[model samples]
Target chain A: MAGERVQPATLSRSEAALVASEGKAPRTERGRKTLRAILDAAAIEFGEKGFHEGSISGITRRAGVALGSFYTYFDSKDAVFRALVRDMSDQVRDHVAPAIRAAPDQIAAERAGLSEFIAFVRGHKEIYRIIDEAEFVDPESFRLHYATTADRIAARLKAGAARGEIRADISDVHAWAIMGMNVFLGLRYGVWQDDVSPEAVADSIAEMLARGIGTK
Target chain B: MAGERVQPATLSRSEAALVASEGKAPRTERGRKTLRAILDAAAIEFGEKGFHEGSISGITRRAGVALGSFYTYFDSKDAVFRALVRDMSDQVRDHVAPAIRAAPDQIAAERAGLSEFIAFVRGHKEIYRIIDEAEFVDPESFRLHYATTADRIAARLKAGAARGEIRADISDVHAWAIMGMNVFLGLRYGVWQDDVSPEAVADSIAEMLARGIGTK
Candidate 1:
């Protein structure tokens, strides 16, 4: 049974005990949970107060973990934020990737991917703030991540163009442009709580992007 | 005569000495000059360190004025940044207005206005950054300004749609999208130091906008 998918009796006994203990006690399983708690706490603190002002002790206290436990996972506040951004990026990509891959055409892919990304941002506003606040923390990491993503998307666009799926003249810069606009708009509309429908905004973006600003 | 353009000989004689000997300087003239100095200093500081980290003391020191003097022109750091953003918006409007007004049609108007705006942003990267960075500094000011400008452009696009100057299906949201995308592109390529040619970026944006993303 242990060799198969069956849970070990000892592991289940520990899990039940840990679940029962909750905030009154801390076990090894609970300690691992504390790591995620710290990240969540840090995300909120960093998003609200910004990077320079956010403190590790504040995050640790919020997470109900000891200050020393924070150091076990992250060396510094910046380290915590970097890991947070990487994690958020992965989460976002996971949320949108299938939608992006499922589109029948390049245009459809962008539209569908953008819509999914918007929903992902709405679902994870704190993580989105962490990603944005990280910009002032480390511009290089922010720029590098953005550029790499843009390049990936641009490569896809280029492939589409080669196959006559998209406009041949579409440059990598426009791909970056599209990416930046999406990022900026999401930050403004979703996280910052601007008074605009995310779907309406995305539809506007997709339509204009599909047709362009030109009169012809 | 008091009504004459030329100053009285006696007044002219003292004015030169007044500029040099009046340690406090002339109030109106000196204040105007100091305001300009403070704005220039604020721009440099905000550009270098971004908004939140930038301080009035730092701006005053950069302007070579007393710290108290900084408060006389601007009520707060927020005030200064708001003024800075307003100033940039004014400069952008001035730079692009004539080209847009003179164009024979929507396409020509967009081409000329957009290109001029891009060239201006390329030449004055700091101003562009200050305006863009306003999103992080004061989302309210940023959105108000963007919406105001966007609405004006949107109105024109709506008029065009009504007149059949553009496709009837195009919405005012698309106008905002166009405005947003051009700015996004220019900032990313020209200001953010993304490795791309401004001309190529402009051309691609123009082409994509002119044509739809549809597989024609």
Candidate 2:
């Protein structure tokens, strides 16, 4: 999946800083790879043990990097956890963006986005734990995660409206309604159980979005 | 709200047992009142300090009840926390039941439920904290809270479908999707900020439910 996407030719100065701790970005490709590895490991560690119980050493060990190498990218356990939240958020966005963009219409785009989201959640079940845990461990990131995602949804919705693909009265409320539906559906069908396929879930929601539950 | 609703003629044996710790249920009206006070205090204490930092003494002091009174209702901090989760779950149901029952149709009932829910959240802002903390402090209660709530929603949606008030295809997915929408809407519009009124939020959703965002 990662291979299918376009890779950056070179990291911008800020992008490099983002890969490192305390505003230090990786200067080389190898450095970026190490940063990515540490984050993946942190996801597993934090997702399993939670924030207080998860440690820098555990992440480094899982990443197969030395303790010194861990600090080279992150200042502390908190920094790494913060970075991981953002990384996961970006991962979801990147993973779902293409499917959404490729959809013929807004409703199809939403259906595609939800299908991809559930698929992502099934593969990375820990994403729910880590993101949910953020509410207690890091409140700011928790707020940012939802707020940013909701904003993105709202933007897509408005764009859809402008193109006459959907109703013109689209607002933040619709965005939030759609987002909440997706989040809980992901929790129920993705994290909790897998009896239903993602395609079916998305299809049901898309049908509802196209029509509605009203009898009239 | 409680006054407007029908009260139980008298607490049944099992109902009495529910108000007290373990097998103890308050036998007298005074005992029931005391139990209510303790639970209310626990909400405040747990809401402010969270489960770990919250203490029995804090709850007692807030309730203005003796230490023995606290012991009479709950054996430990954990017990009270668990009870509080159930209590709040019941509280939300009781508070919203009247409005929902009064609505003209299924769609109107949902709108009313969401409106009343946001209003309730605004007044009892601590609800979000307490219930959310239950996710970590007592996983069982946390799951029960959502599961029970979702079940109630599913039942209501099914009832609406039976009455031909909603589409015949109403299923658990629709129920979960509606519940998710209400929850996040409550979190954003209810708890986070009150810039928008609950009525407006409900109005927007009700409109979407009646038609949907599709241009067709």
Candidate 3:
């Protein structure tokens, strides 16, 4: 299976096996579209019922695809779940990229990215269930998700430092701190309830980041 | 079962039914000690084998008590697991409270709390697995664990603002953000690896909190 794998765009090496392909781009646009539908359905099935209760037939049912079509893209339920974890990670990155890129400074970029993330989570409430479940179903994928996310944040902070918009001593610790803050805030303000404004939450965080909480 | 329940010292109303016993505290000191042993052992058992594979027998064996004794405190495996989640939450709060109290200011208090949390996690590595697994095993317990933890953090932040040690605008958003930061930092530095100094990690976060990450 590993030998026959062809990496999809944005598919990390660790995620390659879960998204099984025959080492070539033989999948037509329709086939790719079908695979996308299957994943989307799996997210709902797993999200609502959880892994133990969720089934492959249910995924296909939700996708409006035949049972055989699931096997075309995934070897089993586990494979699809693994694939979904990576896809969600990529989806989050892709969804928030434009906002982060458009912001004028590092702090603004983080603020926009967080606002966009909360907005995304509100629409895709299943995201927390799916990603949190990865901890038990696939530990490596769970670790990589946060590791990659913190790395991305760290890289951005480094760039911000180079531009002199942030302190010179930024480290991986700061990256993890910011990432953790964003994640829990999203859970509390986005998925759990919707009354708090995302912009307001992000604005508060942005202010905190711009100036320490210590009284002047 | 609900009618006969008695709440433990720190058991939230949501977690009251899990640590089952008669509506009275009739057990002797030794019995109470035995119950404590069972919970600590259950932590190891569930932490290692997880909920499905972890057994009541394994918990008894680790606790060095007989199987019949297990039933004296808990109604069943599910009961013990739920009880353990609350215990862990209480344990974290108790462990960090002294450090937080001794700090000279809010920023130092936060740094101390994060450092203490990372240290606690290093020794009780199973904490992450248990609290996280509660999301699947017992959703309410999982929710209350985080909800209560965040509530405590928010209360502290609010108190800090009153003391003029922190900004007047601190809110639940900042509390969740800080809680999330400490949790992830504990996972990364405490459980995942031991090379990074917990004090150093907490120090950087303290610096960031004391004076926003923005350049002067």
Choose the strongest candidate by DockQ: 3
Better of 2 and 3 by DockQ: 3
Q: Write the candidate numbers in order of decreasing lDDT.
A: 2, 3, 1
Residue A99 lDDT (model 2): 100
TM-score for the A chain of candidate 3:
0.88
Give Cα distance to truth, residue A128, candidate 1, Å: 4.8
Q: Each model's RMSD to truth, in Å?
A: 10.5, 4.3, 6.6
Error (Å) of candidate 3 at residue A39 is 0.3
Docking quality class, candidate 1: acceptable
Any residue pairs clashing in model 1, and if so which? A210-B213, A212-B209, A213-B209, A214-B209
lDDT of 3 by residue, A78-147 (tens): 8889878888898889889999999989889989999999988887878899899999999998999999
Model 1 alpha-carbon drift over 4 Å, by segment:
A1-35, A192-216, B1-33, B52-58, B61-71, B194-197, B213-216
Error of 1 at A154 (Å): 0.4
lDDT of 2 by residue, B1-216 (tens): 221223322334565476457766787888887887788788888888888899999999998999999888788899999988888888889878999999988888899999999998887888888888887789789888888899999898888878877777767887878888998999999889999999999998988776642222
Q: Residue A43, candidate 3: how far off, in angstroms? A: 0.3
Model 2, C-alpha of A20: deviation from truth (Å)? 3.4
lDDT of 1 by residue, A1-216 (tens): 002212111222343233222342234665556655665676677767767788988888777888877766666777777756655565566667888788877767777777776666665676655665666676666766677778878887887677677666767777776776667566556555647776777766766665653222
Ranking of candidates on DockQ, top first: 3, 2, 1
> Model 2 off-target regions past 4 Å?
A1-16, A212-216, B1-16, B212-216
TM-score of each: 0.76, 0.91, 0.90
Q: Write the per-residue lDDT of candidate 3 for residues B1-51, one digit (tens) a residue.
A: 111213223333333334555452214666666777788888889998899
- Among these predicted structures, which one has the highest TM-score? 2
